[model samples]
Target: MQREGSPWRGLGVVTQKELSDHLSSARMLVIQLLVVVTGVVIVLVSLQQIRDITAEDPFLLLRVFTRSGEQLSFVFVMTLLVPLLAIGLGFDLVNSEHNQRTLSRILSQPIYRDALLFGKFLAGLATIAISLTAMWMVVIGLALSALGVPPNGEELARAALMLVVTIAYAGVWLALAMLFSVLFRSPATAALCALGLWLFVSILWPLLSGHLVNVLFPPSATTADALLNSLSMHQAFRRLSPGALFAEIVTVLLDPAMRSTQQSQLAAMGLALVEPGSIPGAPLPLLESVLIIWPQMVGLIGGSIVLFVIGYVVFQRQEVRA
Candidate 1:
């Protein structure tokens, strides 16, 4: 029979402890410092450019900020800095506990293994979400103050959607790091493995895919159509890389002025673009852009969840002693 009011049951205790630990750790301080440094740099760069521009429309200023920030600021932070931060926090989560012999004592408690793992995972996720939200607010505020333009309803909605996508992308890295931590006994080994995986997926995978395509389908006339057929496969394979997915999502979300210039082009390319007459039109709807990214987001997050579940099951079944 389950107790009605007990707080230390199953996963709750684990979640609470993990959250407490994260709150007290140097990990929190490091995350804060990174966000501050990155946000300040973005603001400074934007301000410098704003001074050089002659146009003074607030809306135009806002648009400039969106374009420049999306291309230079957000993409760099999300792709490079954020993944490193996530790996740093998670790469040793399990190994550190094991090294300190705390795992055996924790398992000796009444809590279930699932609870312990779930709590820690949830805590890590919460920390990520909170950190991201803070940085997002800073960006929005800086844009508003510097540009002197309030965000329209659609702009606000798109900002929210972008933030969610960013979090999901970061979560993939965090989960992968956790999986590596559980698989390896030493924290250093786990960290190295996680970083290696990140580098392969984010940087090397694209180059390898391009090389394979060149070698296998060498752009001959007969193979030209074959190359077109292989393009989708290449894209699908590249989608496995989170960096590619994140880039595609950012391209769609940040550039709202993209629409088909003409019906013929739309029919030919199978993508809508900004009409010729609407050079300065409102961006595509937030939901529509998000829909474009749905497949990539699902693939990355689904892969992460699958990996985490496998790690969880393996960790739960492993033997541990004091």
Candidate 2:
């Protein structure tokens, strides 16, 4: 809607152009194909598994997101796919223009750099949202046709909320990728940096956290104070990883039976013993599930914002001389 003289004149046009490029890009198409193909395969196998496990389970639709073949759940698959897609979409967003000697030309237009950066980021996120929606609907439709079970209101609500969470989760990676795009001149290097960070945070952080706990608190000090300290330290360190945060959010949302986030395992067992007669396997109400995951969502969104702000500042100050 911006006019000729406005600084934001080209924002919408640039966003649409980028959106069209993403929709038509071969890489984007391949990523979406992989997601849909794997999702379809997983949902097919999971349906049979669910049938064998429980016929009258109320949350069968919800199970599609968390259940999969050979210990590879759909949510887990996204832990790999989402970040890769984000990185691919953004790793060259800025520097490629510089390499091609087009950045200054774009900057010479009646538009600010903010519009360009924001537009590109928004376009990447829109791509994620669109691709996720397509695959999510496919899974839900197939689950409905195969399972022959009607999803209740609550189940549908949970799925919708989880989709929103998926977009937000993708946004974090998009922001990080954009940050790398601003930092690195070479696209390959930016991608490597993002992928390396993802690998370390997802794989190595937990092991390091465990080692730290063991080194600081010996097995001999398994008493109350040391155990509490160790648990707190592990929690503190794990929260540093966005993957850990996203996983916790997915677990609580898709698994409606999840009540508390930080409750110790021993405390949970004690509570179970005390409430033996209470309702078993009951899903939490929708509002309560949102409340339980509020902090997780906040952390994720805040992390994305911080990364985006850093990218914004860097891009603004970056010398665009080509």
Query: Highest TM-score among the candidates is held by which one?
Result: 2
RMSD (Å) per prediction: 4.9, 3.5
Q: Write the per-residue lDDT of candidate 2 for residues 162-227, one digit (tens) a residue.
A: 888888888999999989988999989999999899888777887897787668765567576666
Best by lDDT: 2
Error of 1 at 302 (Å): 0.6
Clashes of 2: 0
lDDT of each: 0.72, 0.82
Write the residue-wise lDDT of candidate 1 on 244-316 in tens digits.
7876676566656543212222345564444477554566666766776677778768877987898798787
RMSD of 2: 3.5
* Candidate 2 local Cα displacement, residue 69, angstroms: 4.6
Residue 101 error, candidate 2, Å: 1.2
Candidate 1 Cα outliers beyond 4 Å, as residue runs: 1-8, 47-66, 69-73, 221-231, 258-282
Candidate 2 lDDT trough over 10 residues, lowest sum = 266-275
Q: Candidate 2: where are CA atoms >4 Å away?
A: 1-7, 217-229, 262-280
